[model samples]
Target chain A: MKEISFKNDILPLGDKLYRLALRITCNKQEAEDVVQDTLIKLWEGREKLKEVDNLTVYAMTVCRNQALDHNAKHENKNISLEDSGVDGFDNQHMPDERLIYNQRYEIINELINRMPEKQRTVIQLRDIEGRNYQEISLMMNISLADVKVTLFRARQQLKEQLKKQKNGL
Target chain B: MDYKYIEQLLERYWQCETTLEEEQILHSFFKQHDVPEHLQQYADLFSYESEAAQECLSDDFKQRMLDMVDEEPAVEAKTIKFVSRITPLFKAAAVVAIALTIGNVAERTMQDNSVGDNAGAPSIADTYTRTEDITATIHIIDRNQSESMAKADTVQVDDITRR
Candidate 1:
């Protein structure tokens, strides 16, 4: 087999790794930094990765660790909760609908941000990124059962919070 | 799409019993343009997941990383296998130490099992090899003996203790 190029085989994973980092770190700039560190670390360990069958998962695990490290050192203070969801939704709604959408989305984001880091990260991976439970478990360094339980708690909390909002309770 | 099945899946979902496929089905169901009015309230949450996935690193991220990668020392990327990291001398020493420890532990456990099980038989615990070369049966017999004995003791202890 031909040797894998860093730009082709490795760098293309940037977006996926960035999503994972952003999910873990919750700060875009720090997430970007984490992805950069993760990619560089992988490149340094490239010789070892040649034997790895699934580089994407390997890169994800690396990204997760770096993101968590960045999260600890930074305390996520760089995050402005207001700006997080601005780019999350497209501007296809009517002017009034857009305002309502922003309000509802901000509430949901606050609820999600208030969640324990593990539960929120699990929700992001499973719900937003559409990763399987096994992959989430590996990325989080937790068991499969733990992944499901965390996700269930996140979803249940989201449902309850959303329902309360709907009822204005 | 049948809304009833999706409702059931949503229920199972809240219960943490829904399979991944069922969860996907719920997302897809809510993705439809005209979600039934009753279910419309949930449309935002599921759609949020879909929309949020669109977030990606900026275009400049790749170039920044590539530049950083180029600046790093070329010698840093050397391939050092995990096994190769430890000197062969240390590896041999580790192998011997582990074997000796396992053998010693096995001897003690065998002695305990013999005393505990038969009361009359002395634990021989002599299945270990003295040379650096180790026999597989030595470990296997100890593990099997311990496992089966533990299982038997568990069943008996539970059966009689309640009475």
Candidate 2:
């Protein structure tokens, strides 16, 4: 196995790890701390990391566990309203265009965040991260069938909510 | 202005039947300004998924992590057999598999799309090792915090100690 460099191989996983952490923790500061702890832990175990077949999945597993541990400790099960951190549009877009875009997305974001952890995490990994069922199963430590069921519920919930919102619900 | 393919894909998408590539196609279709009126209701859902992936940390956070890494000491490696670590997860997976029941409609939908059964999780000795490292680090942080309560500059170490 090729050796893993902390800078080239591991540091670049920060965003992916952060997204997973944020999905689980639902707090940006807590999510960042989870990623930091994950990175530090990864770096400390760099030797063992090389022995692992898939470092990305391994790193993610550790991150998921760490974030879960955080939630367990702090009882932060509900997603935070303050940390939605709406994405900004580029300057090229007109003000009206940007406002409409942000509003639509923010509503969708709220709908997603309101979901249960397993459903939302599946959506995060499958929809947001674009991970395959196999990879997601490994990272979440769930069966492939379970992954699909969880994602199915999540997408169906989003569809129902989106349709209602469109009808001015 | 034909959108038959997209409509079919959207149907599959709601059923969790669409592949990742097909899902990306939905996202791209919705990104355009000229989405058909009927499809516009679904646009924000796909668009949000695309944009949510772009969420990330700032460069300032990167710099702080680098500094903390520099300050941290080297970790001692321990030798634990791989089987010992993964045996429990296998049991857990078995339990989850037994407990998991796809609904009749979803199970039928999945029968057509099912590709492969899940093999057991890969060896992850590092996970156990990581748990140990965290426990040890927390112990150190606790000790330092108690001893250095008077010091105003314990903030750096406190960052790592923030579980």
DockQ of each candidate, alpha-carbon based = 0.36, 0.52
- Enumerate clash totals for all models, in the order shown: 0, 0
Q: TM-score per candidate, in order? A: 0.65, 0.68
Q: Interface RMSDs of all predictions?
A: 1.7, 0.9
At residue A13, give the lDDT of candidate 1.
Answer: 92
On TM-score, the candidate that comes out on top is 2
Query: How well is each residue in A5-117 modelled by candidate 2, as lDDT tens digits?
Result: 67788889999999999888777888899999999999988879878988889999999999989888877544446655443445455598777778777788778778888
lDDT of 1 by residue, B1-163 (tens): 5678878888888887877787788888877888987777788888777766776777787887777777543444443444466678798999999999999999999788867746544344433334333556667778999999999999999999988
| Stretches of model 2 off by over 4 angstroms after superposition | A76-94, B71-163
RMSD of 2: 35.3
